[model samples]
Target: MIHIEHVSKKYKKADNYSLSDLSLFIDEKEIFGLLGPNGAGKTTLISILCSLIKPTSGSFSIKGLTYKEHKNQLKQLIGIVPQEYALYPSLTAFENLKYFGSMYGLKGKSLDEKIHNSLDHLGLVKFAHKKIDTFSGGMKRRVNLIASILHNPKVLFLDEPTVGVDVQSKNVIIEFLQELNKNGTTIIYTSHHLNEAETFCTRVAIIDHGKLIVKGKPKELINNNPGAHNLEDVFISLTGKALRDHA
Candidate 1:
């Protein structure tokens, strides 16, 4: 569970806030999607929640624990899979995962089993001993996911988890996440893929220019918006058809 109260973030010397009074609550075991255009503060909000950066104003708490008071506890409670690959190009998949597992205080047979099982589950068992530099984009993405969830985090924050992968990889990743959710892991995701969010998320919130524009179930949002046939239609209707290109 998560609670946010009037959370706002403004970087020093910046002309405007990246997040403005953004208050949101994510329930336990819920798959929540944070949808937004380029530079729409989705990443900023997630970074704040992950404690990668402090909010300029207001605050948030995860599972009744604030980062200010429970940084260590929260670290144990959450996992993050960033848009970029977090693997070491020079390290073998198994070695890289072992290193990550150790960061969470895991070791020996238990950690080894966890790593092998995850690699097998993600279709990377054969590549476990291969250097990350030798992996394809999809393989690297799967490895990235394995690294984050090695500790079996209660909440998982994923930014564009399936952005560049082929359809097979994307399907596997989504199915893996769905299984995690079924077993009670809360997921907070951000993506430009509205179709995936429509079926994957229990609830979604669309924001733009650092403000919440709409929040609801995908079906509810589509039905409420007259003439909308799908989540993409509803998204375009609210966020518009303009390109969100940013440097």
Candidate 2:
């Protein structure tokens, strides 16, 4: 469903590429995980795919729709949930959803029903009438997810969807995503949680310094890498034990 060919990107004033000649193909309805250290270009690759940042060199297309050829069509085909909370703190959950649904030209009873249904599905029904400022971080994240998928996108890109949340909240988010993938939403997500990716992803790619070091099913990678018993073992073996800090 997604094809990335010889995709490379280098930031202005940067001495090296953020992503280097990376080519990836993700299947339809697959939950693909991009795992990496701090400066491994996971975010850069995702941003390029979402068209948030133009690639310095290289190209990609989703479901045969390239940004250069069908920007509007691709926009409608994808949904993005960034790491940050994309919500109005002062607004009620219902109001926030209404504004987001209206952006996709949906309104009235149809939009209202979609909003409430999704909210209920994510365990935010009672909170719908409450102000967002009163919500916990987990609630905000769930609401942020609702905003992105109201249009029912074909491909969803999520960056750290479960970061900074309690175990209970993280479980809810992962479960919701699983349900979405089961319903045929192709999911591409970046995460630092190796254990989460091992079970959640159908396939995963480990990138470092803008290059794909390994890509395969979690079990396959663990078996192939010497002394690796799990995804974390394979990850640390490849990316190393050093800290990846950047300015």
Candidate 3:
């Protein structure tokens, strides 16, 4: 289980906290989502959990592993799919996966097989030898995902995994995630795709202004809210339509 306790963050120049005493518990094998308007600190929370940054105060642990005590072990336990492409444009898809796998001490036949399998599953087998610089946005996104999961992590943290992909790519990505979840990989991801999250996520937390406003199963949240026909309705009702103008 992932335990977050009284987490908070305040940038040097920022007046308000990016996250205000946020606390959450994510269960094992659950597809947990953090839904929020821009500047809601979704990214900030994920970064803290991934150990990319330190929180101003508070603490968190995953499966009893704290970043402070088990940084290397924790890295092995979790896979991260950052918002930006972490690919080297000059390398071929296969070459890129090879580099990523080696980072975790994965090599030889098993590693090669894993790379091919992921490529085939993600419909990138034909493009395996293609340069990342020549791949489409969706293709690169798919490759980025494979890089994170090649070592088979216990938990996966994805930040906007499907931001600019086409419908076909999105479906493939979501299906792959579902398969990963079924195999006992706990997934915690952030997304703006309300419709996709509605069906894909088992439960979701809505955050805004660096605070959690609501959380529940999508169907339950929608059914309970009067006149809420879908997750988007509930999202808009709770988050409001105003632009989140911030630095």
Error of 2 at 157 (Å): 0.6
Note each model's CA RMSD in angstroms.
0.7, 0.8, 0.9
Residues 1-247 of candidate 2 have per-residue lDDT tens digits of: 9999989999989999999999999999999999999989999999988988899878899999999999889889899999999899999999999998898888999999999899999899988989999999999989999999999999999999999988888999999999999999999999999999999999999999999998999999999998998999999999999999998
Candidate 1 C-alpha RMSD relative to the actual structure: 0.7
Model 3: residues >4 Å from true position, as ranges? none
List runs of model 2 lying over 4 Å from the truth. none
Prediction-by-prediction clash tally: 0, 0, 0
Q: TM-score for every candidate vs. truth?
A: 0.99, 0.98, 0.98
Which ranges in model 1 have alpha carbons more than 4 Å from their true place? none
Task: Sort by lDDT, best first.
Answer: 3, 1, 2
* Per-residue alpha-carbon lDDT of candidate 1 for residues 85-129, written as tens digits (9 for 90 to 100): 998899999999999999999999999999999999999999999
**Local accuracy by lDDT, each model:** 0.95, 0.94, 0.96
What lDDT tens digits, residue by residue, belong to model 3 across residues 1-247?
8999999999999989999999899999999999999899999999999999999999999999999999999889999999999999999999999999999999999999999999999999999999999999999999999999999999999999999999999999999999999999999989999998999999999999888899999999999899999999999999999998776
